[model samples]
Target chain A: GLAAPAIAQENPKISWRLTSSFPKSLDTIYGGAEDIAKHLEAATDGNFTIQPFAAGEIVPGLQAVDAVTANTVEMAHTCSYYFWGKDPTYAIGTAIPFGLNGRLQNSWFYQGNGNTLMNEFYATQGIYGLPAGNTGAQMGGWFRKEINTVDDLKGLKMRIAGMAGKIVEKLGVIPQQIAGGDIYPALEKGAIDAAEFVGPYDDQKLGFEKVAKYYYYPGWWEGGPVVHAFINLEKWNSLPKHYQAALTDACAFANTNMMARYDMKNPQALKQLVANGAELRPFSQEILEACYAAALSVYEEISASNATFKKIYDDQLAFKKDAYLWMQLSEYTFDTFMMIQQRAGKL
Target chain B: GLAAPAIAQENPKISWRLTSSFPKSLDTIYGGAEDIAKHLEAATDGNFTIQPFAAGEIVPGLQAVDAVTANTVEMAHTCSYYFWGKDPTYAIGTAIPFGLNGRLQNSWFYQGNGNTLMNEFYATQGIYGLPAGNTGAQMGGWFRKEINTVDDLKGLKMRIAGMAGKIVEKLGVIPQQIAGGDIYPALEKGAIDAAEFVGPYDDQKLGFEKVAKYYYYPGWWEGGPVVHAFINLEKWNSLPKHYQAALTDACAFANTNMMARYDMKNPQALKQLVANGAELRPFSQEILEACYAAALSVYEEISASNATFKKIYDDQLAFKKDAYLWMQLSEYTFDTFMMIQQRAGKL
Candidate 1:
């Protein structure tokens, strides 16, 4: 056995409450908080413990940032875009329509100036944000009827989240902001003509395929949306250095784990959904192009109005250009070749 | 301030040495070890320190695993495939020709049965492995002349790494195993017809563009190669649980950060390489297809003889099919659309 150091003896035992924006039922997303707690506890050997609470336990899911801001909890694990109603800048912390994919988002945050830029915005909100989870390039959503063209989106009532709602509204769609739990009920009752949650794994859990027969390919709005652990600024600044270090490492671990879990689980779930009679379809190029135009227009409008949104969004736009260029040249080419082999059943 | 818990006082003060299979100049790859040491030290309040030595300090780069096995160093950071000479199964720990990309590799390791399977193989060698770094989808080697077809490869001498040499050898090419530092001189003096290193950033540092005018896309042999920390199994088993957790978290953090760093750095480096007279080219479809056939043939021969290789390789092949299928459906479509927009200058 090794001897204890002076600093080790000074290590504090701290208990923090982490309220998640997701319900316990959505394990992959909600599990980020659980992973953080479990790993931190194990690393500290009970010296530091983080207690995780599900949505509606301490406060509603969407109100997670508020609870953290009010210091009702030390931190909250939730999607940053969920709080975009407070400021459009919040959406950039997670994703913007037609923005970065999963790999790019992490690259932007960790290597590019993303963490510095977003945290500068977050500091004003009395929160310090650490990306803890991501659902990679989400499915377009479940449509009660096939959406074959831009005309199909007209007057469509869709349960879309965050800034995407604003973009799609430009495409003649009526966007509704419904909580994850309420989305299925709204879709089933015909209150929403379409709905988009995460990808196959989480979407399957909600059983959306039963009510909406056409499941779309890509969710343009929330590509690689990040789930963050937002800690109160005051609480974060007050932490002992080691505790803060542990928290950061814990979040990083959970961030990587969540994406891997989704990638691993989504394939089997999608296969199951198709076998059970769900129709998988890609959104037409016309609809995608229209959505792309709408997303750009929306960004231009916001960029002109809000400097904070403009600063971060502009930086992200620059990074995204180079990122996709590199991705297409290498990752895209390799994956395409492999997919062809897979289709030929030669893999 | 929070109070120290009883368990906190039990935290031990320990120091270990880590040998790395990379030069200190290759910061992104070598940086993984530094990141782990820095994070672990900070988190443990300097109670635990891991001193890292660059390659040749403790042992030569290829001798990393040997150092760890013999307990010359508590741990060593290296590419698992570098030891493929000992056993072919080692290649899968880093990459196999036309195997999983970075995302799929992480997904397979973390969520699929990758860690359990790989570690089982490592146990036979008296080591424990943890993924600490990755260079995402490396660029094909820098060639003095463009490779246009299958005929271009015949009688060519290339400095390639690991099991890739075995695959390329079947293409009627002679493969030389040269160290990173030696490759630049080897390529410059026409000692090797072509030489492959990492992507743009690392390749640029070695001045490969100076000697080789043609830079190729998508290193088919190493789509996503992982760098792992190989710890002596005996040392790993004896660690206090908290220390183990800290080490795991540190490696996980480094693993994620390494890929992000490459993604962020490669684009600008690529631009510089092009501006400096390096002609960028894609490996012709004929070459790719031919090499793909040769790789499969080599795998069959090995699989027929090696049960361990066959078992792990078969499982990976199965997971690869479903992973790529899901990837093409969502990630591919989204990235492709974004790439098209990029080319049109609409991004």
Candidate 2:
């Protein structure tokens, strides 16, 4: 901000509105829109400014995409998976069970033709999906009791969102779909045995660690979940090239900034959670393996029946294979080895 | 490119020149500047354009920062660590031995105070450093013969660059500082026993694989080296606000795009290298541990005598420790588990 240029814009003034899936309380997610607006305004010297409305202030969060498509709003920031009701292909737009991580997802989206393919799908719905933010990776959730095996999942009333809800149901777990604002109380009052939210940063704010002493990680459900800035194609097309560039480029900025902020903030939050009597845990290998198998069948069934899902699933599966190989050799190997050394007190 | 904005800009024309640290032959490294120039020109509808000059045209790649500082060129694209001879603090600006990986490095630079700190340092030299591109995790290097033990390093000659050259030297290896163009022949003619020039993309172009069959990985030295676009502070301050915004935002765009491009391209390149007789190898744990120790001590020695290096080194070390903890818990754990299941033919 200190280095901002001083020249004023000669273009026409413009104002727009952005509806967000997240409430104002979760700054990290909701702030994505605010950041974009800041950059746009700064670049244009206040010639353009966007006002962001939290979920339900205009249209409900889940209906954000529809609102944009209907021209009810100029733009919206929300996870694409929230619209799986429209089509299961939406799930892969955000995150998929046992799918790509943050870096791999970005690699595919920005470089591996994912942006083109997904946007092709979104175009049919009258929307353009600009990847605006990511939540690096989410924690599995806070559980009141530890889950030791696959059998521990039976009849468990757990609050999960999007596609993860459907996948977990196959393991005899009763999926409880609860709104973000309502999830904490449900878990606190024992209405739900467990709950999954963004991560330690947001989960700590929601006070999940207070009631659920057992904190588990590697959110198989939402590995590197991304939020899309859904813009109406008509509205987007009407904007000036420079303005469009500003918005598009700012979305990418928000995307990188969101992950960076989370990466910096989460470690501190995790430490606090552990210090607050919350026990850190990883899902047992048996449980993870079972869920992995269950997830595959669930995906297979959906892809077999849904043409849209089938198309994306096919593309993603192929891409995921290459990503897995490359990341295993580069990213995973580096982190794994470093972790061993760090844990071994060498670093 | 398919989704380019349709509107054209109405801005006045302006032009600038950029000196790059990489030669035209190494597209991956040199392309960072080109990508930035392309985005800026596109955003401004050709009203603003930056002409990128290959190394040795205006000045050698290593002197790029000096060219920018001296206003010999309007801008330059180069890795900051290439100037380690000027000051050890330069290493943290790009990459350090056992420093951050791609995502974590970006997180530190953009999200943390790294941008402000590094820019503050650059300002002292009358320049502005823009975070433009990253190469992700680079390969360890190509060697004519396999290295299995610490004893193999004794009296061995390797063409390594940056701070890594010094760290390896501490382990009794005679470091051979050769130009990129000279590295291949140096190894081929036995002037150097081993050589490294980047990962598969450029290394393949340099014909390292054909001459040296052993390709080692994790790079250990340059985990996620980032390229900085350096602008003369006076020239930058004189640009129009929107033009400044275009350049700054485009740099971020190029940063994301470069890494994404490398991530997508490296997998295929590695595969092809292997098919063409490159025997992939991981540095043995013994060598890695030894280099890591040597790196830490080298850093300590530098930080002990250099105030600037001490400041950034302390900050980076503290940040890396927490990053290690957080990554181990989330990023590492997820990738490791998924890779296991993936390699086991599960999912």
Pairs that collide, model 1: A140-A218
Docking class of 2: acceptable
**Residue lDDT tens for model 1, A1-347:** 23235545466668899999888999999889999999899887778899999999999887899999999999999989888889999999999999999988999999999999999999999999999998899999999999888888899999886788888898899998787778888988999999988899988988898999899988888778888999999999988888788889999999999999999999999999998878989988898899999899999999999999999999999999898878887777888888888888878
Candidate 2: global Cα-lDDT? 0.84
- The sequence of per-residue lDDT tens digits that candidate 1 reaches over residues B1-347 is 23235444456678999999989999889999999999999888788899999999989988999999999999999999989889999999999999999988999998898899999999999999999988999888799998898889988999986778888888888999887889988888999999988898889898898898899888998888889989999999998888899899999999999999999999999889899989888898888888899999989999999999999999999899899889988788888889999988889
lDDT against the true structure, each candidate: 0.90, 0.84
lDDT tens readout by residue for model 2, A202-278: 88888888888888888988778888999999888888777787777878888888898888888898889889888
The TM-score obtained for chain B of candidate 1 when compared with the true chain B = 0.96
Candidate 1 regions with alpha-carbon error over 4 angstroms? A1-9, B1-9
Q: Give model 2's TM-score versus the native structure.
A: 0.95
Worst 10 residues of 2 chain A by lDDT: A1-10
